[model samples]
Target chain A: MWRDHLTEIIVFSALFLLVSAMGFVAARWRAPKDMAHLDEWGLGGRNFGGWITWFLVGGDLYTAYTFVAVPALMFGAGAAGFFAVPYTIVIYPMVFLVLCRLWSVSHRHGFVTPADFVRRRFDSPVLALLIAITGIVATMPYIALQLVGIEAVLKTMGVTGESALARHLPIIIAFAILAAYTYQSGLRAPALIAFVKDSLIYIVILVAVLYLPYKLGGWGSIFDAADAKFAASANPNDGVLLNANNQLQYVTLAFGSALALFLYPHSITGVLASRNRDVIKRNMSALPAYSLLLGLIALLGFMAIAAGVKPLPGAKEGSVDSNTVVPVLFDQQFPDWFAGVAYAAIGIGALVPAAIMSIAAANLFTRNIYKEYLKRDASPAQEANVSKITSLVVKVGAVACIVFLDPQFSIDLQLIGGVIILQTLPAVALGLYTRWFHRGALIAGWAAGMGLGMWMLYQIPNAATGRKHFGGSAFPLADFGFDTKKTIYVGIVAVLVNLAVAALVTLALRAGKVPDGVDGTEPDDYFVDESDPRVTPGPERDADSAREPVA
Target chain B: MTAPDPEAPEAPTAARSRAKDRSPWNWLLFIPIVVPLIPAFFNGDSPRLFGFPRFYWLQLAWILLGVTTTTVVYQMTKKKRGGGR
Candidate 1:
């Protein structure tokens, strides 16, 4: 059995070696004149220009899980999987305006994390701690989702087994290599490897989209097969087209996900790593090119259906893993050598974002939590060291999420993470424009949103697996008296409740004579350019301090 | 520390002018975002193009439209941001 996939294993190992070498060597690439600082280690020295920002932000947003899971979602559910397309499309214009301001403010203040901004903006350590914890909590399941994507590809190559340790040992080994490189190189590991990961994915997807359809007749036949499959299934809401019941869920999920996407610590880290405001703006227009790629990749689900792909039996009895559909489809349809290259693309795809995410999370801890609460006078080198160790601990927690929890549940937990991140929008995103929300009100709103979102998520049961609760993002609208059959995305409802609570509480606070937090940022801070005097000091000071150790 | 090389002259006057033109153009950014959120417009399969359903093809088209809108807005606002300074 292993001998048949020898070419695939060999080719996958070769490319994996190439990426690991790049990860180790990246410690010295661009050499930063100073690796001892957070700006250098965590945010790529905040000097990346257009092309690097494009790829870094692109690779950061679209992950291995996107390559594996979006298509898997399409194969499992019908039109709802396409929500990723519109969400990504809207994210560009939506963030184009917001991110430039965030970049400007962060550059001026030398903020390493989003919660750093919240802490200063709100002047409330408790609220800042909440945001920091939320960032780490929201990111854990997302990193686990990336591992699930890699596991699906590994399972297709016949590397899995019946025993629990046998199934997870290969994953543990792969993540071990990832953890080592990331701890050594920090953000540079992912920034360098993103170039290789994206090129492989582009080639694999271009070939698969063109070749798979021809092998399975054509797009016409693919849709017909998908339509026939969905029509015959017991669920009426699932089919080739979006029914009236799911249309609202699709719209709300897309909009809610669009708002939530940029608010993540990793996505913001990628934006803040750009050299200037213009790089951030130009990338917003260019980044939608990845959305186009995502739209094409999502069609692989329909192609899997046309090719008559079925899920491999999972570890549990009577269980089928929907995540395996795309990987197994590639194995059946492509040549052995090409399949190996595709598998390596997906496996390496996990490395770049996982490295970035862990770095982003570690930055939040070091800047917002460690320095803020633990040691207020920590030096820059000590901060860098703390972040490096924290990254390793964060990756271990993510691995635990996959090993102990169900993989399907990890996907739903990712959506639940989305709900958790959306609660910060009023504080982080809106705080850029105005200070009227009242930091106390923002904290209260966050609590209400988190409380309601988790409660609703607890009520949603998995229809396919017959699980009790916390299985998916869709909740019935009829519970709120809209329509008995209709379901809406839980995130949209929870965020609206968050905003409403924040608004009402703000008014009451104002009437009762509550003091708003002192604004540390100047009005001109929001529009600072690369040439601004405020940004010049941080990098120049870092460079001088870096020479102290070298001399 | 060494003195950093200055790119050009900048003052509060140029910054104020840029901020004035920037705020109104942000409202125009909402067009590409809000139009796509209403699913009723593109839910049907009657107007399939190139063997793809309406739900499929129109969503892809909107991705391009969103990029175009952002590009147009960026071009309109970027000159005032950099040129006046």
Candidate 2:
């Protein structure tokens, strides 16, 4: 078993080296003279054209967790896991209209984070601070999910042991490589590396999808076996597209996840990095193709079950951890060299998102919270420095998540993030059009939404451990005496409360004669294109323009 | 003919009026609006939808049909969101 994982070790090292080497050279790919600006460090010089933006955002949106977890959920719960497919398919066109406008306004105004939009659009720093804090807090568990993805791959390769120190060394080394480049090269690294990451992921997934099915019977046999297995189960509602008990959870998770996808700081980081409105628009139209890929990947769960693919050497029998299902399938079915390629796909996938997310969160801290409150006159170099340090600290926190926290709990934190960030939707998403809601009311609305969402989330109970921070098992509807055993997304319920409060408070505040915050933008900003002079601003000062790329 | 440079002078009308000829039927995007209810409206165990079981095909079928529903709804909200289709 010790020697078994050597192939994964070598595969992982090669991928790390490749992404890192590309990261070192990325400053030249776009070749920004000034590394001091947030645009360069945090958003990859804000010059990514449509094709680069497509691959970068595509890699950013779909992560190692997605590749592992979607299939894992399918393996455990029959068809219920397939909700990811419909949610992703629907998310793009749903947001396509809104995001282009956001891109337009942000580019025109020099906004680095979504909170910048909230601050200006609502004309309230309180609203901006709330959104910034929500973005950072929500991103923590999403980063943790990447660690979970890495851990699952590690376990599949037979790398875990009773020795805790030895078990986590792979992640420690991977994150170290991740932290070094992010600290040195910033967003450019992830931008360059995403091309390699997406290429490897697509290749691995395509091979496994077609090759695995052929080796273990065919599509017809696989579906029949999955249906039979789920049919004999005790839940009784487990085998179809939509089951009665899980239907609400499915629909809400789908809609709620779609809303949350673009709201995550990393998502905004990806879009804001694009060169122009057309890049954002064209990419959204093409991005849904990933969902088509997602549908097949979710079906990998059923395929695993059909092939009678067992868990890794470490896991208990019949109690195969669903997260390891994909890893084991590749390990069992493919040759050692090919398994190495699949392992690298998952590894590089984790690295790209982890870097992008940390950078997104740090940019929020530096721009909205730090500069707005503590260091008002901080120059572009100082701002970039603050972002770099915060990125390192956030990576440390993500490592802590993998070492100590339950992976499922990390998923719950992500759900809570969706709920929290959706509060910004009314202000950020709706604010893209008009400023009908007063700034003070928007703050109150944010407070109400966050409070209501957290209270609902806290009431959820996880039966496995009887602990409750956040998760589906603890959904408050069951405890409220209305007792319908249905689970709905806390974020959806919370966002509704937020919108209602914002509307009501807006009417009240408009009557109370409250002054709204400043608005120095025009609608023309939304239609601004690549050649616009406003995009260039001025030369940002930095000391390291002449430093050699770290080799 | 000139290429009508996207960066050329913007006529104010072109900038703000992606919503110009607003038809009353534009609101019909909200129609199926409620029609996802038809399958659940029929409410059956083995009800036939065309040749296939309503249970198996309804949710899957709605996926394709839902895109049409979304495009039409977006046409109005597109104006509301301040842009073109």
Candidate 3:
């Protein structure tokens, strides 16, 4: 099988290596005076312009996992899979309203992570620790899922081997290159490489949506094919159109996913790395263009069904991996060389986000965990060193997740990751707007929401892979004693429960006259822009100030 | 920690008033989020366009709606040049 696709293997290898080389050279793309500081290494100097931020954030959010999985969901589940389309569409307006404030306040305070903002806003190290740990935990499986994206493309190219080590060798090699360049150049590596990734993704998706549909008859026939496939399927919920039972799930899942998209540390990393508030605002308006792309991408799943593309067999007997649907479709339809380009698109797409996520998670650990607890007096250089090392370690752990655990387990964990990260909304997203929620209340809210989310996820079952628990994100309304069979997104329920707990606890604490933590930020801090007099200077300036004699 | 500037008291109030003036436009952001979630607006298969179902094409239209709405709000609320409040 591998021998049959020499043209593809060569093209994929050439492009993959080209991006990896670009990753190393990116260290000097916008070289800072001090390479050892967090701002320089972890954030690309916090000065990415509109174009870079647009591509970087788009590449970060629309991961290779999304490229593979969203369509795969459409291939398997039908209309429910289209939830991703609305999910991406709705996220921009929501973030446009909120994230500029975060960017402004973060610039004012020199905050590298959301936990940093939480730590100061609430003046509670414990709460910051919770946010930081949740971020790292939620991010790990997400990075692993990026690996799953690359692996799907590789598998479709017939790159598998007999031994376990052999099967994962290609992924390990690709990630090792990613980990190396990310270590050398930090956030700049992914920032630089995202250009290539997005170009490939746009070209491949546009081609597939246009050319494949034409070849497979037309859009009407594609929809008809999907409708017929779902109509003949055993499950009543599967179709091109929403059913009564699944409609609630579709809406709630889309909404929940939109809310959860930016809460992840990686999304925040991209947002904070921008040059200014206007950059964020412009990107917010412009970023939905990717949603248009994502909508087209999601339709590839239906196109696959229309083209009669069958999925490759899974590791287990009689099971098939639906994640391979898009890759397999590309393989069967496109010429060998173009198929390799699509494969490289997916492969490089994985690398860009994996690098950003590791950097984001590493920043969380170094700032909130390592500096706050382990070594309070660590300098900026030491902090950068820790983050650089932590990023490598995180990637190794993500690779281990793919190697040791079943890929299905990582997908399940990624679902739970959205829920877990949304638990931070009250503390991170809302706290940006108001500090009314008390510190203790926020922590309690997080715990309650996380606990309930896990419980709810455990109750839902996936009939496809025969998993009894932790199978999917759609929770049944009947489980809450409602008579209806309609299911809703678990994240939506968990977040509402989280908000209620936080609000009630806040009220209780206020009534008891419990002293809330000091608010370290002022209103003016949230409005500070680039080059503003009040904006915090970089660590180099702080160092210079410390070295100066007292007046 | 520095001594309070003479302009401090009026600065926040001016900013506050400006925010209040623009707050109505911010409400437009909710249009995109809310409109797409309403099943009745887009839950049907009739009214196909370009060989696509109404449910599918309308969702794509919502992306355009969101982009346009956000762009309008962004333009309306954009801060003026020369650092004016």
True-structure lDDT of candidate 3: 0.90
- Model 1 Cα shift for residue A305 (angstroms): 0.6
TM-score of each: 0.95, 0.86, 0.96
| RMSD each, Å | 3.9, 6.4, 2.6
Number of the candidate with higher lDDT, 2 or 3: 3
Q: Candidate 2: which pairs clash?
A: A460-A474, A461-A474
Worst 10 residues of 1 chain A by lDDT: A542-551
**Candidate 3, residues A396-455: lDDT per residue as tens digits?**
999999999998889888999999999999999999999999999998999999999999
Local accuracy by lDDT, each model: 0.85, 0.74, 0.90
The i-RMS of every model, in angstroms, reads 4.8, 7.6, 3.4
lDDT string for model 2 (A315-341, tens) is 333444678888888887888878888
Candidate 2: stretches off by over 4 Å? A312-320, A463-469, A473-485, A533-551, B1-85
lDDT of 1 at A387: 97
Ranking by DockQ: 3, 1, 2
Clashing pairs in 1: none
What lDDT tens digits, residue by residue, belong to model 2 across residues B1-85?
A: 1244355654434344333323454454334323433324322325554322344344445445545554554455445535432
Q: What DockQ results for candidate 2?
A: 0.11
